[model samples]
Target chain A: MDNIAGTKSSLTWAVHISVAALVFLWLFPTLGLFVSSFRTADQIATGGWWKSMFPSQQNLTLRASPASEQKLEGSLYVIEGELFEEGIEVEISRWGASSQNISTYAAGEVGEFRSGETVTVQANGSYRIESETEISGSRGKRIFVTAITPPEFTFENYQNVLFDESNREGMAKAFFNTLTVTIPATVLPILIAAFAAYALAWMDFPGRSLLIAAVVALLVVPLQLALIPLLSLHNDITTFLNGLLGLEGANELKGKGYVGVWFAHIGFGLPLAIYLLRNYMVGLPRDIIENARVDGATDFQIFVKIILPLSFPALASFAIFQFLWTWNDLLVSLVFLIDSTGETTVMTKQIVELLGTRGGNWEILATSAFVSIAVPLLVFFAMQRYLVRGLLAGSVK
Target chain B: MHPAFLGLFTILVGVSVCVGYYYFSNQLLDKVLFPAKGPNAGRNINRREMIRPWLFLMPAIFALGLYLAYPVVKTLLLSLSERLPGGASQFVGFDNYTKLFADEKFWEALQNNMLWLLVVPAACTAFGLLIAQLTDRISWGSIAKSLIFMPMAISFVGAAVIWKLVYDARPIDQDQIGVLNALYLLFGGQEPQTWLTIPLANSFFLMLVLIWIQTGFAMVILSAALRGIPEETIEAAIVDGANPFQVFFKIKMPQIAGTIVVVWTTITIVVLKVFDIVFAMTNGQWQTQVLANYMYFQLFTAGDWGVGSASAMIIMLLVTPILVWNVYNARKEMR
Candidate 1:
């Protein structure tokens, strides 16, 4: 029985090992993204992120001097630069004008050139040109320099992605734009919803059931159905009412209209917001509101003095969800917030264009992506304690 | 028009939350907002009490009405029209609906959507279940959970970029540089494949990206549900000599049916309007058009407002029954 049990334990261990391997296979791609963000585009293009830790020796070509200037002094036309210093072994390999046939010679190998020139490269970053005469050309000579690059990492990509003025359309602006939309977008819905939720959850009203049903029904309606018709309606409304508000025509307000997008954000955010907030507000201890009501507290006073204070966890958690959802939104912002020209492009759109232009360049993408996600991450982490507790509150109760 | 909207708007006149932040010290709310552990509850119900909540709610309602409600009405109207060039259309009742039935691309899109609705949610749930089970066995369970959950945090647009690299194809003769093609060659395939060009194969390939992203979402929710299962029930099942698989299938799963439905429906709703991934990845090209992408092309790209609105209405109508079911479930969970 002991031997049989031991064999079963080993089998269980084997099963566990295979499962662990599957998990790693699943996770490596995103992990590669995080790792690749810190690497050069060239490096990422050449090999996997696993190889980045090791030092790599790469051969590079440098144009040092002109071929015609070679006087053939001492049976050699010497063109030299500070490419190699003492104690630094700079090596040269194959050389060609066409990048297609770049790898023709081995480092430290002698070659007889078609120009009647004999060339040999050295390991110590020096080469000997034992040519009968120098080749002729007005343009500088084509020389290949191979160097061993030490393991390197830089914050330059992150800085460029995040802080460069050219990147003003970057995370900084998007961060602020996100805040502009998110703060009001979140705060407004809760303010409205809290009152409605309070009414639905606590206070009595004639149309209360109808309103609750409406919001719940609204929750089922996906936002994608609203995108185009919404934009044209916005244009029409602005046109119809631009006369009333002393505002420019609908097309003129164009991409700069935060009014349209702010409305869009709030609309999409409402039903769920009201539902979530109501669920939370409804769950608050009834005794507190009842006691407050007995102490001359009207419905308004009860909401203010008792219910709102107790509903902190729910409010905070909802805010985090609203902020993250609105911040990461591409579709709503693209249709509503984006201008006729590309001027008002948000960070998410900027990152998207960067993907189109610099698709293979992981450094630019990863750095920008990290920037785009930084706020959401920070919001999630900061209010995370409230988040799960809030959204999940109504479920268990 | 809600009483909540009216009451708050009336009371908050002149005095506002934004204004209160600056001069709230002398006011009642400074004391009321922080009652007891705060200041004592100030004056109970006063003039500001009536309008305060609605004061806050008014901007939100106005915004919701203008952006959300108006478009819904407008789309309903546009769905009946024969759209002209200058945003004008002749009202054509139900002809758009007639065209909707006859269009092959519409049916193809509808079929593909059903395929997504079937394939993606089923695949996502399976992967989520697998990961949840395997990770539950691991020592560093949260680490595994976090790794899967990490994808959930990225915007759909960001995931598209990560996938573009994974699906990137080069000439078959040159080099199989894409990860999938490279794997195929490594497995001794004769020629590199254009994974995107193969219609059914590409659909499955695109589905993988959606599956990749959503598996994490499913796992987190399901993991939470799994955690909610009572330990004693499992112990009881084990004592009955039920196998581990039996314990999972019969014992643990039946307990969390509601949570499973919630996660599945939520992903279903998300999959219905999936635009960014399909748009960014394939731009809905080569038999890749889903409803949301097709709606976008019809409306914005082709400027066919009537058909677009009708399609939007159709998507909304399709999602409605599922949503009603979900709301019913939610109410059940609530009660």
Candidate 2:
């Protein structure tokens, strides 16, 4: 006993360290995107997200006020100004009058300029150029300064991605489109699966065992096979319905819309939903169901009153799975829901388009990607217990 | 209508339809088709009891048959035919399969998918088991586990963008914006590399995203299995002077071997069906193709339904064994 306890205690520090390392490894990529979304385009382009939190040293070229703004002060033609724009905070580490020697003079050190002029640059990006002769050139003398700028972050990326009406790549409509596809996709399947699961679990049927096996088998079927056939079928049905009803332009009634996606999601989600719900429903104690039945409550009443509440964990679990799957889905919505008009495009498709069109624009890509990721991440954290419980129920057994 | 309103209307219609179907169908079955309160009450009651289960099961069966089972057969048929313009198809009889096999890009996708299959599941399972074991006795285990598991929620496109930033590259003489290039340059590499444009390594880079997402899944399931191990087995091992490694390997590992297989197969299915990551990241360029994306390219981009359906069949072929295995296990469990 002593040896066992000693060994465990000795390994505790190792366990903590390894777990921390794993967590950091997993969280780093997402944290990078999250950080990148908050940063301006210049910051994202000039430095890695890991450097976004700290003051970073940068070499910037700033000019003094233009020659027009130059003034004569005390027997000198002088130009005095801060290198950074107003309200910007930076520490000038080094300064030079020429681009060839950006770091030639130390901060607060005086350096000789062209001819009889001398300039001193302060740490706070303030500088003065004085010469007995007047300053020339329409442009002020170009001053090269190496400065350390504090970390800056903004909500502008999110605004551009989510709200800017002119940005064709904005995720605002795509976000709503995804929600339209997802809610019914998630809810329709659960309601249908719950009723079916109750029958499979508690009610007696001739082929219950076979149905259970079929559900399990269907759980592993790759949905890739469903795409082409389903699309053709939907098209054929839509054309037929249009001709029969003489509703030519109104063919949009069923082929591509929220209802189409809802049905498709139900079709795809049913096997797993039924499998999960039945597994949960089967585990419920037989006595409660039997007592209710003996007291003359119908199966529907029993399902609504007894099993529904009792199976809340299972329902919640499957809801999260379906919700996440539907929310994150690309192929289903791409094939079934979205049309060429691009009005019904979901976030996944929107992000894929951004990846192609605005591939180098990390601000847009990161912000749009994060917007799509945000809802599922929220669902994940909030209903994580049920999600895990569902995984264990679905996979482990 | 506005999509949000349309969505709300769908919820209302879908819910009411489902509720009404079950209620009306059951009512019609019990009260109309075979009324339980009739002169033949006993027979009517027995008949209703028998019919009620099917009524409950009808919608799910219709959905499953139409959505899943029918598509399997339809896709198989489509795979063997040449789809022409204007909704007509000729029975080409395996021409698509031959053409697909002959295409080098299809072969590339197959090879990369093979590499993905061989790597992602093994790496995820190993890392998952490692994390599960390491975090088992720690105080912040759940917090650590949650953080690691958080990526599972993110869409593949989102993950691709996340990793795209990580793999973003700039030429030397400029500050490196991407983390990988930055680290490479910081450690003294000549010229920052374009990570995604490289062939074999790029697939691995993409595989890294899936592995990151799946490892947490493997850990959560395996961790639960590890906890489920009977205390007596470990106590007995400890009493017998077994080391911690011995207890874990000889005792705990064998007990959870079944679950490890389960996790492996589940992740394997995910790897087999992997599309969005490659689609969003590379779209099968630079030898980063997988079958799903290749099929998508064929169907949509290239507009070849026969070849596309054939590739879809190939994915179905890969999944069939798992489907059989799961059904077998389910049958055995039921028995």
Candidate 3:
């Protein structure tokens, strides 16, 4: 449209800049979490994630080798050691022996301790403490350094959050539990809604339009309204079945498990599932169905053989939608699947619990959150076309 | 058995059962109950056609009815009656509603929800439209749109964690870890603020998380609507000396107004039932309670089913107009 008149608009740069700003504004929060996940606990605590890309100045309290490591050389008893551990490269700009004046001495300058020991610390973190008398304490002497540490990132947080076995807050079990809930929940709804959508679209029946309208109305029905009644219903059914079957105690259905959550997801997902599939199915070329009907193919056969295959895009669309929805859902899983035992917790619930317990522990929180978010994000970016297609089909005319 | 194994087993069984139900029921209609090879073949074929649609629909209907339709009525009834001691309920007309009305917390939640209703949808839609229009002519528009739309996949809890890092606070003496506080201090603020603990502003901060997630949705829908606008109409507008802004505001905007309404109401419905974000972020602390969280608190924490169901009904009531509007549109589209 801008090129139609052979005149370039001056606002083109504005358009680019505004879109860039909008995209940056949208991406910044998730980026912060993603960056924080890789940072160590001390790094996250002392600085913002935005500052993590550059080398940061940090105030560190280091200890020289313990007084027990002191060695007598001629007339002087000397304690010598590196303040930082092996392989850590930091440049100490200033050094001090006391807490009150941490930067009193520059690196490579000697500062006297309260015990009349003189300590000279190098920028490479090697320090020498010399005294005329023997150092007697078992613990190392305290040294404070103002060091400029290089930019550092680590996979240790991910290792601890996902791979560490002894960590009680590990997300490994919860990751599997999320898969357990998500697969059945996503698959069952598509099957059930597919058949229903086929019938609503192709099979001639009284009140077909009404059924479609009902599905449309149900699409916006908040799943919040379903929580209490369905929970009670599940419990009642379990009790009734247990009584009839003469089952009791631990063997009895607790009414909250994978099966209950699956059903809840199916129920919640069906309206949009049916609505999307039926809309797509209705738009399928009309003569194809008529041709199949004339060729002595049953409605079931036609739907299974022709319609299902032809509706691949629509099916893929709904599958991605349902997959993301079920995988990321917290409320339904919390109310239905996870009980007081907390054994069956999904990642989202686990992350929320971590939020409460480990609020200040951003390494754990960010790593755990990113672990849960990783799959959906992959599915989102990989099949975003279908997701957008599904959204447009589901929402817009 | 392990839950993952159980899940795999359930998927196999559920799929086979649905497929088997459709297949066996169709076979029963054809072979046994209404045999097409019989002397009454023609009549049997007609009868089977009449029943097959219902057979195809039966499982979906049962599931939907049990899960959704029945719950709406059940919740409505539970709202009017209080629970008794022994799994029984006594009829108490409007007692729950009255009790809920008298609670200050309920009023706070309702007021905050009203604020959310007023702010979230408008901000999302406006931002969505702006992004959609802005990204339309750019070279990397699709990539920009996809990045913007990426948050739609993140769960509310995940988003809460993300934004929590953004709003994290530290003491005045320490370096601020949260971006908001860091920027606050950088921009000449005296002290870092605990963004989520402040009264009125905290709600908006929470709403920012939602807006961040939902604007993606609104953008995707409205972007499609923008592309759907007729090219000739835009060209005609431009030919008539309509500047770029005028073309978008006067021409393109009018064309996609219906879609904007759809996106708005769709987001409104989402906002109405937004529980996880509030529950995860503040858990109704610091005056950030919304309706869904309030209902969950009533039902689970307080063990007040009557008021919980009442609050659920309030959400349903708010949704009813959109529901009716949608159904009406569907019916009209069918005609």
> Highest lDDT: which candidate?
3
Q: DockQ score for model 3, please?
A: 0.81
Writing each residue's lDDT as its tens digit, candidate 1 over A296-353 gives: 7656557677887888777787777677777778888888877766545666777787
TM-score of 1: 0.80
- The order by descending TM-score is 2, 3, 1
- Residues A1-397, candidate 2, lDDT per residue (tens digit)? 4457435567777878878877887888889999999999888888788887888888888888887887899899887888887787898888887877888999999987665578889999888888888777887777888889888899999888877879678589989899988898898899899999999999997998988888998898888888888887787888787778888564445677666778889999998899999999999999999999999999989999999999999999999999999999999999898888898999999999988998989999999999999999988999999999999998825
Could you give the TM-score of chain B for each candidate, in order? Answer: 0.83, 0.98, 0.99
The 10 consecutive residues of candidate 1 chain B with the worst lDDT sum are B36-45
Instruction: Candidate 3: list runs displaced more than 4 Å.
Output: A1-8, A66-82, A108-120, A126-141
Full ranking by lDDT: 3, 2, 1
lDDT for each candidate structure: 0.68, 0.89, 0.92
Measured with C-alpha atoms, the lDDT of residue A332 in candidate 1 is 84
**Model 3, A226-322: lDDT tens per residue?**
9999999999989899999999888988889888999999999999999999999999999999999999999999999999999999999999999
- Name the candidate, 1 or 3, with the larger TM-score value: 3
Q: What lDDT score goes with residue A72 in model 2?
A: 90
